[model samples]
Each structure stands twice: as structure tokens, then as C-alpha cells.
Target: MKKFPLLALAFCLATPAFAQSTQTTADLANTVKYRHAYQSMTKLPDWVAKATAVSVPAETLKLDGKSYLVGHLCKPHDCGDHQLDIVFSEDGKAVWGLLSRRYGKTLYQMPLGEPNTETLAALTASYHKNNPDDLAK
Candidate 1:
């Protein structure tokens, strides 16, 4: 009887931990898939819209154990001869700005602005310079 109670207690304790681990694994996998999908899209407008649509998976938990999703969007330029890059992230509940730029050996970051025709034009210009074939749209 004592052994039975002890076994029950152990099982109870292990169950939540196992569930949490499984949840984390699933969340990480989803994050990776979103990252890849964001990378594969060639158009800026589509990329922004897609990034904005990302939501935190149900399995994610904040540091406080509260569940939340964060989304981030960024545009970056390399200072001098370096390359420029734009990045975005979404966790489900909210989006974040993860912009960065390099300026003469220094790095700068700013939030992504709302997508608009003008912004798309600028992105097209930059993309054309970086990847001519991307203009196939």
C-alpha cells in the first residue's frame, strides 16, 4: 500500500514535467518552421504579412510560466561594404520589432514600419540590387 502511494506520487510529479518537455519541443519545432517559411518568401509585402500572421504555439510558455507569443519584424543595413538584412519574429500573441543595421562598423536596429507601397518600392530597389532575379514578380 505504501509502495502504491509512492508510485502514484512519483507518476503525478513526472507527468507534468513530461508534458512540459513535449510542449517545448513542439514549440521549438514550430518556431523553426516559421523561420524557414519567412526565409523562403521572396517578396517583401508577402514576407511582412506572413511574419505578422505568426502566433505563438499553444505549447510556448513565458519565463513566468504564463503562455504568450511574441512577433518581431526588423530591417537592417550593413555599414560600409557589409550586407543588409531584414528579420521578423512572431510568437502568436504579439509582434516585436527586431531591426538592425551596420553603420561604419557600428550596428543599428529599428522596428519595422507598417507595410506600404513606398516601403515596398524601396525594398524592391534594394532587393533588385542584391538579388536581381527576385524582381521576377
Candidate 2:
């Protein structure tokens, strides 16, 4: 009886994450290559790097004839609640990005704008429901 309740409790606690995985998977893809991914991640904007709470290593992704690497950001380091998505040039030479979970729409990489689907999916999976405006576009 005791073992049964413990097993049930663990599954119940983990249910929400499983429920949300499908939604997140629909959002996107990226895998960071080991070599130089760390170097590339270091090129993020001053505000972004300083603000990052949890940092995932950079992943190399090819898009639109450009070689790009993406870094994930969660929670601001200042102990405030905020999120960001950052992308870097493979050589650590420059940064390219317009990620979801950010403060504003403007970016240094693509000055004009891009399709919302491409931009928003760059963020964490939870962004989908929270940022309806991003999905609508």
C-alpha cells in the first residue's frame, strides 16, 4: 500500500510536464555542437548575458544560408522574472537574434522583422500559450 501511493504521487506530479511536451515539440528544434558552441554563446549582448539565470550551451543550426547557433535563457540573473532567446554567429564574431520571451521586438541581427513562427519557437516550450501574439502571427 505504501509503495503504491508513492508511485502514484510521483506520476501525478510529473503529469503536467508530459502534457506540455507535445505543445513544446510542435514549437521547434536545435542541438548544440560541442566544439565552439561555448565560444559562440559568449557573444550574447551585455544585457542578455548579465540577465541570464539558467544557461544552456549554444547549438549550431543552419537557417537561410547562414550558420547560426542558439542559446537558451531563463529567469533573469538579477533575481527578477524574465526570459530571453539568443543566437550567435558560429565564430563568435557576431550575434543574430529575435527570440521570444524578450522585452521588445527590435533586434540587432534582423532589423526589420521576421515571421512570428520562426522567431517565437526559438524560446522555451512554455512560451506558446503565454505569448498568443507571437503565435497569432
Candidate 3:
């Protein structure tokens, strides 16, 4: 009877480790796919210039005490303006997508993806749907 409680406690602790391992595999695969897509599309117009000018440094940090990789994208001319700080899992799966503004105004958190014409168009439509304020005047 007492032994049952101890056994259950041990199982509970072990379950999280098992779950993390499985999740890591899926995260790794997704990261690889995303990276491949980004690399392939980096040469295309509209994105090519910006992608080339932007630098994404690799760093590890803790968010809510959980470790994550920080990938940054800076603006072309003014590196401090409208910077994007993308948080990814250790395996490179994006966990949090945020747009940081140096001007103290909130910017929309747009989805990140490769610059394929079709993919970009689809993402733009989705972004507009989610954030109507981004529409041009």
C-alpha cells in the first residue's frame, strides 16, 4: 500500500523525461525543415536583400526558467529599430515569435518562414487576417 505511492511518484517523474525525449525528435525534424526552407528562399527577391543584411546570432537563454535559443533579426538601416527576437527550442523549433520595437510601440508578432512566393503570400494573408492594422494606407 505504502509502496504503491512511492512507485507512483517515481513513475510520474520518469514520465516527463520520456515525453521530453519524444518531443525533442519532433522538434528537431521541424527545425531542420524550417532551416532548409529559409536557406533555399534566401536568394529570392524582396527577402534576399533584407535576409542578407540581417544577422541572426545564436545564443541560449532561459525564458520562465526554461532554456531556449534566441535568434535575432535586426532592421536593415537602423539596427535598433523594429528588431525581432525569435525564441526557439533547444532543437530550433520556434517557441515564441515576437517583434521588439526600440521606439516603445508594440508591433505585431508576425509568423516567420522562408521567402517562397506562394508561402510568403499565404503568410501575408494570414498576418493581415490576424492584424488588420498592418494594412497599407
Candidate 4:
């Protein structure tokens, strides 16, 4: 029964870590922290709204030495031209974004306001991972 107790302790310790990492985009959207951050925007973009409406898988990634929940969201039917990569701090207290749009042969990426250089770089890297062919020239 000593082994059983140790097994129970391990299971309890692992549950939160597993749940935190496995949260999907839909799960984060419903969070109060996420809602507050998103709603606080002064001029919300239309594509951002549309993209979040669709559910996509999310992953926990390390960005700038901190854990962040990252997800790729895109406009339905026009995903090739418009896409958004969102990053939320592990605590869900902070948020950052990268918006990418393709026009003709050129692709443009605009980071939300001025995320730190490391964050912007990580976001861009994450975006490219999602779209290997969509390189930012």
C-alpha cells in the first residue's frame, strides 16, 4: 500500500500539468482572462473575431523563456491570405498576437502593437511552423 500511496501522489501532481498543456483554443476562449484581454482592445480587427470563432488545437510552447499557450487561428476559406497566431502567458494574464496577410507574392506580418523582440520572433517562428510554405520575405 506504500506503492499505492506513491502512485496516487504522482497522479495528483501530474493532473494539473497535463490539463494546463492540453487546453484547446475553445477552452482558452471561454476563460475570463482571455475574454478580458481580448475585449480590452480598443479597435478589434474583424479577422481576429472571425478566427477565434473557429476552434483549433492549441499547444503549450516556451517563448522567451516563459511558458505560453499558442494557437493558430485563420479566417475560414481565406486562410491562405489571412491568419493569426496568438500567444497567451501561462497564467493567462498576458496576451500577444501576430497577424499575417499575403498580397500577391508578398507576405506581410504585423505584430500586435509592440511585443518584445523575442516574442515577435517566436510568434513568427510558430506561424511558419504552421505554414511552412508561407515564408515572410
Give the Cα error of residue 19 in candidate 1, in Å: 69
Question: Which regions of candidate 4 deviate over 4 angstroms?
Answer: 1-44, 50-55, 135-137
Candidate 2 vs candidate 3: the TM-score winner is 2
Of candidates 4 and 1, the better by TM-score:
4
Best by TM-score: 4
For residues 1-137, write the lDDT of model 2, one tens digit per residue: 89999999999999987875443332332334433555565455555647535656767767667776766555545312344556566687765444433435532222113324543454333333334565566
Q: Using Cα atoms with residue i matched to residue i, what is each candidate's TM-score against the true structure?
A: 0.23, 0.35, 0.33, 0.60
Worst 10 residues of 2 by lDDT: 106-115
* 116 Cα displacement, candidate 1 (Å): 26
What lDDT score is found at residue 9 in candidate 1? 93
| CA deviation > 4 Å runs, candidate 2 | 1-52, 76-81, 99-137
Arrange candidates by lDDT, descending: 4, 3, 2, 1
Tell me the lDDT of model 1 at 27: 67
> By summed lDDT, which 10 consecutive residues of candidate 3 come out lowest?
42-51
Count clashing residue pairs in model 2.
Answer: 1
Candidate with the larger TM-score of 1 and 3: 3
- Winning candidate number (lDDT): 4
Each prediction's total of clashing residue pairs, residues at least 3 apart in sequence or on different chains, is 15, 1, 0, 0
